[model samples]
Target: MDHDETGCQAAPEGPILCINNCGFFGSAATMNMCSKCHKDMMLKQDQAKLAASIVNGSSSSNEHESVAAAVEVQVTSVEPKSVSVEPSFSFGFGSGESSEAKPKEGPNRCTSCNKRVGLTGFNCRCGNLFCAVHRYSDKHGCPFDYRTAARDAIAKANPVVKAEKLDKI
Candidate 1:
């Protein structure tokens, strides 16, 4: 029969207890919060719901008011663990480029592969140089401003938009 500072009966030891007199019990939630604070939080949630209903012109007692305040309470809190990790995309050749500006790469090495791009080579719009095997934008992972043009072109030609009007006509 131990009552907390709020005059609420403290939950019996070794049990998760909710804030209200109803004493919501849970095994997963007992580690952090005692019952009293949980009750106050629930009360604030209910009050918010009531205020929302009033503002929406839906009488709280009218059996079906359109306004509703939904509050979700999670009792059990999880602690996140910290760990260091490295990205797997590293090709083991030193951490790529520090600058976006395509250096005077001498038109030799394919960015995707360190192979010598001889006669068959392509320079992607991303300004990087690559061999025929990784020439296309996708093959060499081209990060450029070209996507917006393609997206705009598709929208302009969208046949499903029946309401389209041509200004030229």
Candidate 2:
């Protein structure tokens, strides 16, 4: 007969009452309890859990404090002092120090043709990087058994279901 602010007709019987008997409309969520009652219940539960934790923690507090004290003493005794060092400069090229070395092969290079594939390179199951041309298993002669893997996946997805045998009276 009456409509709410959203212009939807109110329930013919009545608004659903809260299971907590709080005289408020029940929310399907929060297990049919009103928002206020649900919030209060949650707060009470949290306080109870906190009290239990405090009661349990009191027993182990002394052990933790002793370990913390030991750690603090060790940290204080081994305090590191600041040290300063001047940088040494070398003005010679090819100084036999070998600061940088060039690698024969890099990840960006394709293993098939040694081409610089960069981000376009594909890592095959054969444990080698290949360009678009040789990315397929057939192209690189990949040793991994794809047929066995496919069969296992199919078997796992479609499990064998056997009906239970029933004895006739």
Candidate 3:
């Protein structure tokens, strides 16, 4: 059992203290209070760092979409506007691929690891349809800004994505 500042075991009756100060799922209080401090449990560093990054509107290791969006935003921000002097933010979403849609060519094999990543999360830059193990997140870390990647993923997965047919081609 964990104890708080007073050396008394954390009370099970009150709100259980989160095991880590930055827990997103639950708290350590459910188990017990701090053994040393005997106080409410706090989030651990890894969890705290993740939570802080999220709060700051940045991308986290767990959220890949956030990383992608952050990247797009960063890419756009660096370009200077010739006509407008005022700051502006745009929310343009990505084009979607239909489930029924078939690739006109052949399955895109990753040149690096040769894994069949399918069309999902394909990195246009490297021409790789790699599994998560070979993707940028695992390699270069989440490239997108947490906020942008997260928002983009959410937006992409939401109702906005309409399935289109490529039969016209």
In terms of TM-score, which candidate is strongest?
A: 2
Which 10-residue window in model 1 sums to the lowest lDDT? Answer: 85-94
lDDT of each: 0.58, 0.68, 0.50
**Tens digit per residue, CA lDDT, model 2, 39-126:** 8799778546544544476527775554333222212233267444322222223446553346676558777788889899999876
Better of 2 and 3 by TM-score: 2
Clashes of 1: 1
Over 1-169, each residue of candidate 3 has an lDDT whose tens digit, in order, gives 4456568864356555445544333436444433433332233444455446655876656575644443222233334554323222222345563324355976666545676666654573434455666666456454446677678888888856568877875
Off by over 4 Å in 3: 1-103, 118-128, 140-142, 148-169
Instruction: Report clashes for each candidate as comma-separated counts.
Output: 1, 0, 32
| Cα distance off (Å), candidate 1, residue 21 | 99
Cα lDDT tens digits for candidate 1, 109-134:
88789888866767777887788788
Clashing pairs in model 2?
none
Which ranking of candidates, highest lDDT first? 2, 1, 3
Model 2 CA RMSD to the hidden true structure, in angstroms: 24.7
Report RMSD (Å) for each prediction in the order shown.
21.7, 24.7, 25.1
